[model samples]
Every structure is written in C-alpha cells, then in structure tokens.
Target: MSSRIIAAAVAVAAGLALAVGGAATLVSLARPDRGIDLQNAPAGNGVDGGVVDYGTK
Candidate 1:
C-alpha cells in the first residue's frame, strides 16, 4: 500500500483504539463497587454496621 494510505489507516486505527479505550475507562470508572469510599460520605453504613473512614483523619 502507499504511504498515504498506510498513514491514514494508522490514524484511523489510533482513533478507534482511543475511542474504545476511553469507553472502557468510563465504564470501569462508573461502576459502584468501591470498598468504602467514606471520606465524602462518612455517615453511611459500613461493613460491620458502623461508620468507616477513608483515611481522612
């Protein structure tokens, strides 16, 4: 293939890769499986039915 075609293919691949990566990252970040994010929400219930501190003391 020509250099221009190859470069265009590479640019398209890179854009697609970046788009997919960004989507995956957003999905992963949107999950609510945190292990006690209690700093901002200190009054919430905890593992043992108590309050938890996320090291903000």
Candidate 2:
C-alpha cells in the first residue's frame, strides 16, 4: 500500500484505541459502586491533625 494509505490507517487505529480507552475509563468511574461513605467513615483517623499528615497519628 502507499505511504499515505499506511499513515492514514495508523492514525485511524490510534484514534480508535484512544477512544476506547477513554470510554472505558469513563464507564468505570461512572459506576455507582457505593464508594467510600463520608457519613459512616471512621472518626479521628488523623485526617485533619496536620497538613499532609493523612491518616497518621
């Protein structure tokens, strides 16, 4: 096949790959899997103890 035809095919394949990946990511993130419950989360986990301390006592 010609160089132009090959390049076009490669570009189309790359675009499809990107579209599929992005759609999958979006679908996974959109799923209502009853994620972390802030209202019922453990208290005093040192979340606000200090800056960037994050769950550390």
Candidate 3:
C-alpha cells in the first residue's frame, strides 16, 4: 500500500540522518580545536603530573 511505502521511506531517511549525525559527532571529538604547544609549555609532571599513579599491587 501507499501508506506502507511512505512509512518505509521515512524510516530509511531517519536512519540515514542518525548515521550522519553520529559520524559528525565522532569526527568532531577526534580533532582538537587548539594545537598543543608542548615546547613552549612548561613541564611539571609530564602529561599525568597531577593524575594518580597506580604502582604494582
């Protein structure tokens, strides 16, 4: 029926939208806005300076 065809088209469109949105979100999260200036920046405890270090149990 026509109604069934319309419903199927809507579902496919919605799925494509969600897939594009998810891809955009992951791409955004993968890149940094500002570049890190490690050479100019002072080092205190390296990358994990304040982070707690778990020694051998």
Candidate 4:
C-alpha cells in the first residue's frame, strides 16, 4: 500500500511536470518575435514570412 501510494505520487508529479513543460514549449513556439518558423507559403505567393509574421507589417 505504501509503495503504491509512492508510485502514484511520483507518476502524478511527472505528469504535471510534463504538462507544464509542454505548455511552456507551445507558448514559446507561438510567439512571433522569437518563435520557430512553421510557415508553408506557396511557391509564387510573393509573401515570404513566418507563421506568426502576419501583423508585423
């Protein structure tokens, strides 16, 4: 019983840590100024920019 409780606590802690890390990563990625570029512009779109660079102009 004690071992099970300990395991459950550890699992919960790990899950919370992973969730926080994932949220932070997504927030960082969604930022425009310093986020990663994930755009998929067409070949002849004539608009060369990142995914979050729409409002900077």
N/CA/C clash count, model 2: 0
Tens digit per residue, CA lDDT, model 2, 7-27: 999999999999999999999
Ranking by TM-score: 1, 3, 4, 2
Residue range with the least summed lDDT across 10 consecutive positions in model 2: 45-54
Instruction: List TM-scores for all candidates, in order.
Output: 0.52, 0.45, 0.50, 0.47
Distance from true location, Cα of 10 in model 1, Å: 0.5
Evaluation by lDDT, superior candidate among 1 and 3: 1
**Whole-model lDDT per candidate:** 0.82, 0.79, 0.81, 0.77
Show where candidate 2 strays beyond 4 Å.
34-57
Give the lDDT of residue 50 in candidate 1: 70
lDDT per residue for candidate 4 within 1-57, as digits (tens), equals 999999999999999999999999999987785323436434445565534445664
Candidate 4 wrong stretches, greater than 4 Å: 34-57
Best by lDDT: 1
Model 3 residue runs over 4 Å out of place are: 35-57
For candidate 4, the TM-score is 0.47
Q: How many backbone clashes does candidate 4 have?
A: 0
